[model samples]
Target: MGKKLWYHSSCLLLFCILCTNSFAQVKPADFKYVDHILGYWRMPTKHSTFTELWVKKDDHTWEGKTHRITGRDSVEMDNMQLVRSGNELVFTIAAVADPKSGKPVPFKVTVLQSNGFVAENPACDYPQKIVYKWKKEDELDVHFKGVKEKTFSEIILEYKRK
Candidate 1:
């Protein structure tokens, strides 16, 4: 009788632990702050302009496209998607010039806030982290950071709402 009671207690404890872990997993509604990034943004250089347009696809997904324009020529740089997967918010990218035969890369979002989010993919060669922050209502700042040539390096791109 003692062993049976102990076994039942242990089973109940394990069930509670599993329930708590499942409840702790991330969900689509938790990323509602991501809606702030929807719209068009542009960064202009002396010779070219880089633009990103984000659109909400559904309650759990957002799609973004990036393009570079110089003179009368426009070229797509990449396609990006922010999606709520089973237990994570993933940032997936497929770049036109990707060296890995254009295979899409997936980065799991680690931080989420009202103004920004950080996504990381440690397996990527160059940029292992991508951070997006809103500086103001009209300004957006994006940082790409990783190890390059055995040294830590970062690239920042500032965009204005267009």
Candidate 2:
């Protein structure tokens, strides 16, 4: 009777171990937003209104090219990596320094959409924080608080598929 009990207990233990192992082997797939986020998105910043072109490069990352098209193609920025962060997406904007000699400084970013169109991150100032909302017609609205008055801006750009 003792031997039978030991054999059954060992079998149950083995079964439990196998089940746990298989569950651990399962991995989650990366989130994909190329269809929803690709193309051009225009939003105003404190300095200028700019347009951003987002292109999907792979399953785990995307590329962004931003430019001040209102000027003579003057200002431009590019970033190649962006990863999903919890229920949102996070990316970094490289600081203006040579990567070979200087350490990389990132302008931390978080992306989300709400109430028409919105994107925000914790790095934004408290209260008014970083926010983007689409305005009436074609323009997109942006707000960032300052010491006194709340700075408001607008972005006028048309988004189209490549």
User: Per-model C-alpha lDDT, please?
Assistant: 0.86, 0.47
Across 1-162, the per-residue lDDT of candidate 2 in tens digits comes to 999999999999999999865543312231432235555677555666567676777665667776765445547754434554444444444432335656333323333433232233333333223333444334444454323245454333443233
Q: What are the per-residue Cα lDDT tens digits for candidate 1 across 49-150?
A: 999999999977999999999999999998999988675898877751257566677888877777888888888887899999999988999898999889
Model 1 scores a TM of 0.77
Q: How close is every model to the real structure, measured as TM-score?
A: 0.77, 0.40
**Model 1, CA-based lDDT:** 0.86
Q: How much is 86 displaced in model 2, in angstroms?
A: 8.7
Best by TM-score: 1
Q: Which segments of candidate 2 are over 4 A away from where they belong?
A: 1-35, 42-49, 70-74, 78-81, 85-88, 95-162
